[model samples]
Each structure stands twice: as C-alpha cells, then as structure tokens.
Target: MENRQENNLVIKVHESDNVAIVIQAGGLPAGSQLGEGTTLAVPIPQGHKVALTAIAEGEPIVRYGEVIGTALAGIARGDHVNETNVRLPEAPALENMPLATRPAPSAEPLDGYTFEGFRNSDGSVGTKNVLGITTSVQCVAGTTDYVVRRIKNELLPNYPNVDDVVALNHTYGCGVAINAPAAIVPIRTLQNIALNPNFGGEVMVIGLGCEKLQPSTLVSDQPVKIYENSQAADPDANILSLQDESFMGFEEMVDGIMAMAKGHLEKLDRRRRETCPASELIVGMQCGGSDAFSGVTANPAVGFATDLIVRAGGSVMFSEVTEVRDAVHLLTPRAADEQVGQALLQQMQWYDRYLEQGQADRSANPSPGNKRGGLSNVVEKALGSIIKSGNSPIADVIGPGERIRKRGLTFAATPASDFICGTLQLAAGMNLQVFTTGRGTPYGLSMVPVIKVSTNTALSQRWHDIIDLDAGRIATGDASIADVGWELFHMILDIASGRKQAAADRLGLHNDLVLFNPAPVT
Candidate 1:
C-alpha cells in the first residue's frame, strides 16, 4: 500500500456499523471503491460523516465499535451522516449498573522484549543518562539553578552524551500545612525524581534546612550527593565559596560519568532492531488542546494501536479521568474485574465531590480552544477523548504517583490537566508517551520523550516540528487507521532507542511539571 496520502474520503470504522464517516475532501468520484467494504461518491469534507449502509431513524450509529450517537432521522447508504442526522445520547447511568468485568489471561509469556537501556545498580532500566540537581523546597531552587547554570555553561560541553542539566523547581515545600501527613507528598515526589530511570548517574540534592521538607531525611540507597544550605552561616557566601572549586570537581566527575555513558551509548547503538514482543511495551495515552477531530481521528487510531500493543503482550495506560466522565460507562465493562471497575467508579465519584466542593461544575470542560474547534460540552469532548485506550481490558487502576505493578492494560486516574497527568504517568514508570492533539501543544516532561500526534492535517502542517505523526490522513481518506497504527508502532520503537526526536525534543520544550491534587483545603 502507498505510505501517505493527501485526499479525504469516508471510512467504515467498524464492521458492525451501518454508516461511514467523511475524513477528508476532494478528488473522489460519486461511486468510487476505496478499500474492503467501503466506497464513496463526491468529496466529504473533514469532520463530516457518510453512510456505510441504510440506517433507520433512532438506530444507534457506531464508531470504534461503540455508540457515538444515535440517528435522528432515516439515512441512506452513500449519504453524509452527521449532526443533522445523529444526536448525542444521554449520559450512561453507571451508578446502578454492576461494574464491568474481564477474565484474566492465562499467563502467556511475552517473547523477546528488550530495549537498549541503562542498567542502574538498583536493577531499573534508564532510557537516558543524565546528572540531576534537585531541590527539596522553593528556597533551594535558586541554589539548584546556580549549580545547573555553572554545569551547563562550563562542565556539560565536555560530556556531549549527557542529555540535559535540569533543576527541578516547584511552588510547594514551605507554605501551607507542612506538618500534615500529606507533607510526605512532596518528599515522595522528590524521591520519585531521584529514582526515575531517566537519570542514569549521580544526583545532587540541595535543600533549605528550615523548610518542613528536610533534605537529609529523604535518603535513598541510590547514589546521590546531598547538600544543605542551612549548615553554612552565610548561604550566599557558601554558594560563592563552592562556585569555582565545585565547578572543577563537578567537571571531573562528569568526565568519568561521560566515559561510562559513552560505553553505554555505544553498546546501546550497537543493539540492532529485533522483533521484540509487544507485551514488553508500556504506552501512556494523553490528549491536550483537543478539537472535534481529536475523538474522530487521532483518538481512535491510538485506540487501534493500543489494541495491537496489548495483543503483543505490551501494556497501555489512559489518564485524564475528568475528561472521560461521561464515557466511563463504556470502559467499565472492559475492566479486569468488578473491583477494578468499581475502583474507577469510586475515583470518579471522589473527583466529582472534590469539584462540587470547589463550587465547580463537573461538566465545565472543553476549554475555550476546544469550543472554538466545534466541541460544545464536556460530554461531547469526552465521548471522543476516551478512544486512545483501544478496547483492551482495564487490568488495574493506579493512584497519582503510584507505580504500575501489573503488566496488562491499566488506567492511571489523574485530573484532566495535561502537565499534572503527564507527571503522574511518568512517575508511574511510563518510559514513553503518545500525546494526541488537535489544537497543538508544546509541553513535555523532563525525563520521558513525548510523541505528539496531530489529529488534523492543518495542525500537522502548521506545527510539523511538534507533531511526529498525522492522523489527518484517516480523516482525509488517504490512509487506513490500521495502516497508520502499525506505522506509529514502528515509530515508537525507533523513538525508544533514541533513533528519532519527538516534536517536543526538537523544539526544546521539555520543562513542564504538574502536581496531582486530589482535594482542596476549605
């Protein structure tokens, strides 16, 4: 098959569906056969729908093998199907329904799953080799910044393989209820950063002694160099005192680290591509700057690839719990067990309560940009947002910053905010992320490489540097969803091995962070 195209056509998303949708416009005849079980006539503009078979009024219209809407009027084969004929269904009532359940698979070992990665002393595999300077509180942020500036301008050039010099800065640590048991949250967050597989070498942690978050107490068996500014009578004087001397010492330390890193990189580069078992793959699905096409093209295509990953024995994670509010019913049935499904429901309930207490409507989503792109309500946006997970069984539900212990498909329940969800997913040990966007986004995490997929051709052309793949072709009838999905799968493997740079990396836009907040202090 031809690799990519520049036209639009109607496509039948599922065999059970009686209608097809328009993906693109131009250069097609009234009666043209495109692929197996699909045909078109005239041009169907992007976001418009077409009929696959005759449909009677009130019958459900299926996309991605689930009901996206119901027919409002009788529709014929070869005719456009859209808002005129289809209306969104009422939110599925999940409170009374028994949670969805799925049978556990008989243990089938995944075959040949491995990546060229750094093996830490602790046995965890790292995707990148870097030296990090972290701070325990906002007060120490400046010190960490000074340390990083000195390293980046003077020491880092000597070590070309070191990915970056980053200072983890945040707004928390000193203010608010510091004595609350919840204060452990910041400490745990810091530990997660140090333990992240992205950091292959030593880390220098700096902290203000007066802060409730004591840097000395957060020690780990891992290799880290801790420094407390409070010990010095003059903190600024201490910083100046360590400048030149510490710079020279750090340069030598970096040289040795780079030598070891060079050997690791060479070995990693020598590792040739092999057919790794799909089960070894763990994917995180996220959406931001969404538009109407988000649910129609990129989201479902991601879903297709997600299914392929699962069948290959790899795992996938879907977050942004609030965005999928109305669509959770569709996912519950696929849960690994009733309890898993119930856990998801309970989390959603808690999210609703939190929002209610804040005097915010749970349905007030689809940010301004989303509405400008033809999305009307949170319900409409969410109906399309959940497509990225595919139809894999929901094997588990993970809390914020929690590690995903099981290997099957999982749901990391996080707020709809992109940065917050991204941080949690990376903390949960997701090495790679597939972020879909219709409006375009330039955000990425410090450690994990984000592969940005554009839902429309216009956005892809406008922001080619940030978009790694274009799902617009599916909308334009230029590529089949399955074909695009497989193409993305290979692209992911290449990215994992550092063979390709994601759009965010190319733009140097990788310093976004978000703290997952589950409740509010009233």
Candidate 2:
C-alpha cells in the first residue's frame, strides 16, 4: 500500500513491513510529516527506506515480509534504514525446505496472440533473420570482426531479407585448460550460440588453425543440445580457418570469411517472416543497476508480463544465481514438481560451492551502484530480483550455458554480472530479452533485441532515447502492474514481429559477448 501525506508519497510493500520508501524526487526534509503519525526523523534520499516504527538494536529489519538484515543499533521511528545501520543476515538453510507444494496456477489461458517470425528448418522460430559468424578461438576475433564489417557494408545490401550480420566474438578458446571439466561451459556456449534461432540455422565458424580449441569441436555432435534439424554437421564445410596454408595474407583471410558469410547471407536472405504462435517466443528476464523501486515497480511489472507469457504457452527465463540465492526458499514451493524443485536447489547449491571456491560469498553482490540505489545487501536485492519471475510454476532448471528445453517458466542459473548473464541467455536460445534498471545502464546485446524497462519515471524521462518502457507509473500510482504488464507483453510481440524496434536497437547500441570461463588458464 501507499500513502500521500502533506505531499509526501511513501510506499510500503506489505502491512507487516515496518519500513516504507520515500517516493518524492530529491527526497523529503527532516521533520516532514508522513502518514500514520510518522514524521521524518532525518532526511531520506529517494528510494531509500524509512523506519515506520522504532525498534531495538539487533532486531531484524524487514522488507517484503522477510528479514533483510539486522539493526546494528537502536533505530528510531522515521530514521533511515540502510546498510550503515544494518548487518547482513545469514542465508536461508537449503535443507528440508518445501518442494513443489504450491497449487498449480489457475489463470485462464491467454489465447489468439500471434507474431510474424522467421521459421527455421529446425522447427524453431527466429525473431530476427541474421547471419552469425562464430569464432572458435579468440585468436580469430579480429579477423572475424573485420569480415563482419566488410560483409555488412559490402554484401549485406544485396540481401534485403537479412536483418544484420553479427560476429560471435568472445575471449575464450585459447590459453585455457581446454580439457578441464568446467571447460564444457564455454565450449558448449560457443556451440549453442551458433544454433540460436535468430541465426536462421546458417551456421558459420572461423578459427586459427593451431588454436587449442578447434573449430570442428564447436560444431561437432556433442552434448550442447543443438536444436533439432540444426545445421551442426560437416564442420569442414562450415568452418573458415584463417591460418590454413591457402590463406597467404590477412586480406585473403578476410576474403575467405566474407565469401562464406555471403553464402550464408544468400540463404538467410531467402527466408521470410511467417505467422507464429506466442508459444514460439523465448524471453530472458534480467535486471541491473537496481534500486528499491526495482521490486516496487519494474520487476513486478515484468513479473506480471512473465505470467502473461506463460499463460500464452510461451517460454520465459529468469537468471542471476547470486541474486536468487538468498530467496531460494521462496521459490522451492513454486516448482512444478519435486524433481524441478530439486533442480532449483541443486543450482543454488552449485552456485554456493562455486562462490566458496573463490573465497567469495553473496556479500560480493549488491554492487556499489546497487547500494547507492538503496539496496542494503544481497538479501534485500535477492527478494527484489526474484520478483521478475512472477508466480509461474518452475517448469524446469538449466545450469550456466545450457540450452532451455521446456516451455513456460525456467530458472537459468547464471552469475549476476550483466554481460555474462546476457551472453549465457543467448546461448540458451533467447531471441529477445527484457532488462530492468534503476541507476541506469546503456547495456544492450548484439545478438538479440533487448527491451530496457526503467524502474522510475525519472530514469525513463532522463534516458528517454534508450529506455523502452516506464514501469515507474506503478510506483506513482498512475498505473497498476497489470496495466504496465499488458503494455510490455504487447511491446514484446511487436518487437518480436519486427513491427516495432526497441530503443536500444534503434540507437545501434550493443555490448560485446563475454563468455563465462570458469576453467583455469593453462
């Protein structure tokens, strides 16, 4: 619930929540009277929390009806509740938690929605028709990039049906323990990204002849879960080796790549958009630069949209393992079954071990930008971040860099870094993504269309050119989550259908693909 007293708007998420966030831009002054006989004990920044009731030291500081932290000292009513005065709380125990105990979702099925998309021979749908050139080793990224630019400027004009040419460049495939057990993560990531639906199944690979990770291994029939009928065969035909004996110079290498790309472009240019059901859409949900309003507005609105997409029989993925670690207890019961529930726990436990191995913990998250935006710690941030998942049953779970197989909601485990999370989602077959931010970011992906949703109207209006939607209306009481959600859902279809372009795409913004290489350097 929310209240406006003396022109001061305060948002309290739950009745049991003893704190409420100040909503006024630039914040309110000390002595300002808030509702419920509460007066500002001190000035509070916008999106920062204010204690609604006085509590003794060592008491739990609650938000979203969960303990986010413990007060380090006695806190007075209307005082600020922030990291300085709050100590981090222990994470929830993973043992003996409820599993698949929530009742099945009963929302009426959303029907009659369709979008124009490119249908691949593999029976997968593509939101964009692009020729993707994959590089097996980082040694070939420069040459591949040069070829991509040449193809885009020289050959792309003739292929009017093709959308864009992307160089799948990353810093992997060399100087690493290629045979390490964890090496499969980056290797398969490179492979599955080649099979992304938007590439139109015209897979192309470029590599240096003597690199540790061979180009053939990328397209080989391994366990990367290649889409059915995908073009993952005849590696010699698909790969262009820059260091081959026939390539005498850099120019020849460039020409060789462009020649291969032109062939893929010709096939991609022959593809046309056809009507596909909403179920064909695979959307990845992520958040960055989050403030308290991330949960109050943007994420919840995205969550509502997530539920809508699930109802329409489409697939949705919510990732960022550390961001979800502290809130895993809230999700276990929502799993589709005991097996799915256990999968969720396994991913959480795996991430926990991964963090421990690095001598890090969940405290490493809720970055400085996040802290400045009023996220006290990872615990508070986790509660807010999970709101992007909505209330859908956990249909399946996949580890880092694995492809999503089932429809509906799936938790794709990934680190909290914005670039890494986005890259893995691409490998997992996401054709479109919706990212929420509050402190603001210019983050975009070259492989997919990313819809940026701002958690506050200030950010939306400030970064008007880049932000696709304003979920801030929910915080200001100008709209409901359902209203913004429906708008977002419609926008997703429009962008997926190529009927409308996201602001990021229109502005030609893109981030480099950063692979998650957990293996050791050899």
Candidate 3:
C-alpha cells in the first residue's frame, strides 16, 4: 500500500452533507484544516463526523444524503458531530407510503460464479456439514450439552467429513406462554434451526417428555422419530425423556445419548463437498459495532457483493428491523412488485406495534457504543445499514425464522441484537454470513461461516486476526468500493466453497443461539 498518511483525511458521505467523518486514526486536532479553509473548531475522533459549515439549531444533520438527525444546537464548520448535538428523529408512518417506487435493480447481473458446497438431498446446498442436536426444553440443556462434548471427544474424531457437532440450545419450552398467539414464533425458530441446511437435515431432538414443545410438534414438519436409532433398547434413545425410567443413572443417560449421536456422526461422515453454482449459496448480511464508515465503505462494499450474489441467483438476506426501519422507504420502492412493497410495510408496521407495546421507540436504540462511534441516532445508523442490500430488488420479505423460498435479496425481519439476528438468519437457512463492524466484535456462529469486514483499515490492522477483509482501504483512497467489493465477492465464493476459512472460523470463536421469544415469560 502507498504512503496514504497524507491521504484525504475526512469522509463526507454525501455531496449535500453538512458534516463529514474524520478518517485519521488519532483524528484531526483543532487548528488542522480540511481541504482549503475548513478549520477544526474541536478535535474530532476517527469515525466521528465534523461539521461542514455553520448550521442553525433544529436543522437536519445529513449523512448518506438523508435526514439522519437534527442538530440540537448551532454547529459551526470544523465542529465535532456527536449524538448530544444530533437529536433523534421520529420514525416514518407506515400508511400510504409509496409502493414499488423504483424500477428493477439497475446493477448488471453478475455471472459464472461457482463454489464447492455440500449439496443436500433436498436440493439445498450447505457450506458445512454438522450434526445438530436440538433441546426441546431448557431443562435438558445441561445433559445434552454434556452429550455434545462427549461426542466431540470420542465420536467426532472418526467423522472427518463432519465439520462440527452443535448443540442447538435455547431458553424456551416448558415455561412461559407456550399457547399464546405469539408463542408460535419461538417454537418456529427452534424448529427451523434444527432443519438448517448446514445441519444436513439430520434432526435430533432432546426432549424432557413433559415440555409443552414436545418432539412431535417441534419436528412436525419432518418425518417424526424416523431416526435410525432404536427406541426400544435406549428407549431414552431419541424421541427423548431424559427422565425415562430406562435411564438408571448418569451412565445410562450418557449411553442413550452416545447411541443416538454416534448414528448421526456415522451418517454425516459419508457426506462430501461438490462443485456447485453460486446460486445455491444462502447468505445472511449483518453489521455490529458499527461506525460512520460503515455506510461509506464496508457496508457499501457488502452491498456491491450482495448485488453479485443476487445476480448469480443466490439468496442474500439483510435483516435487523430496527436498523433498517428508518430507511425502509428506500427499500419499499425497490421491491419486486406491489405485493413485496406491501409485505415490507406490513412487517415494519408489525415491528412498530411490537415496540409500542413495550412502551419504547426506535430512539431507544443506537447504543452507547454506537453514539461513541459517531452514529448520531438510529436513523443515521439505518441509512448506513440499509446499503448492505445494494440496489438489488427485494424479491421477498419473510418474518423471523421463516425460510425464504425466493432467491435475490430478501429481507428477514429481526431485532438488531447481533445474536438474535444471526440465529434468525440461520433458521431462515443461511449457510454463510458477511458481518461488517466498525467498532468491532468477535461475534461468530458455529453453524455457518461468518466473514467479518472492517469499516476502516485501522480496525482491520488492529484486529487482522478477527476481521477477514479491510474495507477501510476505501476510506483512505487505497481502494474503490468496487475494488474491495470485487475482492470481497470473490472471497465470498472462495469462503463459500470451503477453500478459505474466515478469521472467526480459524479462531473457533462462536456465539450461542438466542431465540426471539416475544411471548410473556412464566
């Protein structure tokens, strides 16, 4: 890389912007000049925005050429733009918004992309082959987790083709409003996770026998209890009842579990990766620990790569309802048709009501970490967040945990919380993930490959062991969004083909599954 020390130091996200983010690592100090005469009134931290010119109180602070927030006090040229100076704005009403407002996605379709993936019997392809053991109730989690560890030590070594053994555990079942109208949500989430393509459709359930979420209903979508393991010998064998009388002690319990797990490992060991088209890839896109450069660099590069995947007939999901809520108008118009537009609005409305029911608003978001990183409010974060969808037409919109039947860019409705969002995306059948972080996180999931992209080179350099791509190069003029995007796009194919391991994968860093349970807890 060239000596970019003298490179353009401030990033003005849009030409109409009244503020720009300082890109220098230590930030430009007071008296330092940007361009010719914009002198800093105060030092601005890296990723923090600087006022472009004098602006009156109550005026909109623009970023990405959109109304991200309003200035709470008069801001002068070279002043730092912080959340205290930027007031949060109200969310848009769902009624009568424009529908199908944009023409078909304008990015030319990409072609000839292929990857080596695990093609399943159901026509879906996965990037990894793993044995997943799902717990029907939180009560059995301890026992099941023990079984998973035992399998890893004693059985996994013999199954070279299987990537891992993930215990799909969560805090639902037995307690709380199981029969409530919204209870179906968490149930559906756990059920689908068991069916995630990466698991090779090998559904193994550990039930307490008395939990409301019985294996019968949890695995209702699949052939029930058809696992080759015997129910008579280790009657505690499968359909599950950790309390089954057949289990005399901990040893008997362990034996039953090992019997079931061994069967899964043996079958999974026969699976192999084969060359597959990029269309078979189901990718979930997300961002965490974000900063201003996210919209300008990493996410945009992700957006470009998103377009590449969509054009190749692959499914890409950009989720986090709160993150995209404010910028949704930009999305509805890009919907494939009026139905998609309506569906998009409906989900937004649902989330709006969901928030109101809790007596909260979108303003409650854009966490303290977000504020420190220069996101003035949720609106600005949203504007930057939505760009990950690129300009691709949203072919469909699905509720959390619902599998996407259509390819192209699909919006999966989920809370902005990283763990829950990733879990929902996994249930939606994503075999791969692209996560952009400006502030940075070590977040990863065991079920799929999560490729991390840094918004700035500084973060990439610092966390090179964790971040897979340095999108910050775009901020320093070292690379164009297209340059990094093409690099990332090819990287996705390689990663999807299992030819490369993401930093998280290499370090074995992963987060636990967190189901989206809106029903009342008992």
In order of appearance, the predictions have TM-scores of 0.75, 0.96, 0.96
Mind giving the per-residue lDDT tens digits that candidate 3 earns over 1-522? Answer: 011222388877667777788888988889888784688998888889888888789998887778888889999888888888888888887888888878884666667889998888889998999998888899988988898889999989988999999888898888788889888789889878877888887768887778888877767766665323246543223455676776778877777778877777777788899989899989999999998788889999999889888888899999999998999888888999999999999889989989999999899888898888888889999999999998888999999878877998899999999999999999999999999999999999999999999998888989979999999998888898889889998998998888999999899999999999988888
What global local distance difference test value does model 2 have? 0.88
Higher-ranked by lDDT: 1 or 2: 2
Candidate 1, position 223, lDDT: 32
Candidate of highest lDDT:
2
lDDT value, candidate 1, whole model: 0.66
Q: Give the range where candidate 1 is weakest over 10 consecutive residues by summed lDDT.
A: 233-242
Q: How far is 488's C-alpha from truth in model 3 (Å)?
A: 1.3
Rank candidates by lDDT, best first: 2, 3, 1
Clashes of 1: 12
lDDT of 1 by residue, 1-522 (tens): 112222234445456656544444333456666454456644555444566777788887765566766778987766666555676676566587556654544444435545555555554555556665565567756656665666667666666666776776765666656556545445565567666666653554555556655554444644333222232322111111123233356444334333332333333333233333445466789999997678767888888778777776777889987787778887788887888998888878867777887798654676888755545456667778888887778889986677777876888878888988887786677767899988888877767778888888988998877789999877776677787787787777777667787878777788546665442222
